[model samples]
Structure formats: structure tokens, C-alpha cells
Target: SDVIEFPSSIGKVTFTHKAHQELLKDCQKCHASPAGGTIAGFDKDWAHKTCKGCHVEMKKGPVSCKECHKK
Candidate 1:
């Protein structure tokens, strides 16, 4: 196995197979190729766009810290 560092405007967000799989309800929901114009770019923003997007929109979960802050 290998570990890699991914730097962003905020900080590094590690990605793992287990962590990713646990979040998706279906493949086509967020991983479609050539993704639509509204789709998020990087992993961090993608997570916020998908996960936190629903949470905040529905007002059911904690307001994500990263959603408003840069770091």
C-alpha cells in the first residue's frame, strides 16, 4: 500500500476505498464520467457538494464546517 499527500486551499483530505464506498448510494449518483456542469471538482468539494449539500438542504445534519470556511 502507498500513502500520498493531496494539498488544497484548506488542507489535505485523505481518500480511501472504504471511506468512499460507504458514502455512495449508487455509482451513477455522483461518479458518472464527463460529469454534468454542476458536478463538483476535487474529492473534498465533491464530498461537500454531495453529502453536505443534502444535509444542509434538508436541514437534517450538522452544518458542515468546511461548507463555510476555507480552512
Candidate 2:
């Protein structure tokens, strides 16, 4: 139940690893590498894009800033 936090101007973004794992069974969903391996070392922009993209497509989860960032 490790929570990864990212610094932001609005607020820190706390990502719940357990929750994401529960929702996405495969790690590749977000950790997919260009070489088709593992470990992409994605940055904040990539995370924001991927997360918001999936959330937008699934029509579930939070896409808004305030929803994820602490206000």
C-alpha cells in the first residue's frame, strides 16, 4: 500500500498504488516501455497524459486537477 507523491504548484498529487493495481491488473498499462519491455521512467507530463487519457476514455475516475491534487 505504497503511495507515490508528486510535487505540484497546485498541490501534491498522491497516487494510491494499491488502488491502481486493483483497477489495472497489468503493470504495462502504465509502465509500458517503447522497446516493449518494462521501466519507462515516465515523468510527470507522461503520467498526467496517460492517467487523464485512460480516465477520459473509461469515463471513470478523476480527470480534473482538484480531484487529484490536494486543494
Best by TM-score: 2
- The sequence of per-residue lDDT tens digits that candidate 2 reaches over residues 1-71 is 45778788888888887788778777778766423333456676887888888889999988998988894
Q: Which pairs of residues have clashing backbones in candidate 1?
A: none
Clashing pairs in 2: none
- Residue 70, candidate 2: alpha-carbon lDDT: 93
- Please write out the lDDT profile of model 1 over residues 1-71, one tens digit for every residue: 12234557675544343443455545455556533233446466676787567667767643556543333
Per-candidate Cα lDDT values, in order, are 0.52, 0.77
Candidate 1 regions with alpha-carbon error over 4 angstroms: 1-6, 33-47, 55-63, 66-71
lDDT of 2: 0.77
lDDT for 50 (candidate 2): 88
How many residue pairs clash in model 1? Answer: 0
Ten-residue stretch with the least lDDT total in model 1 = 12-21
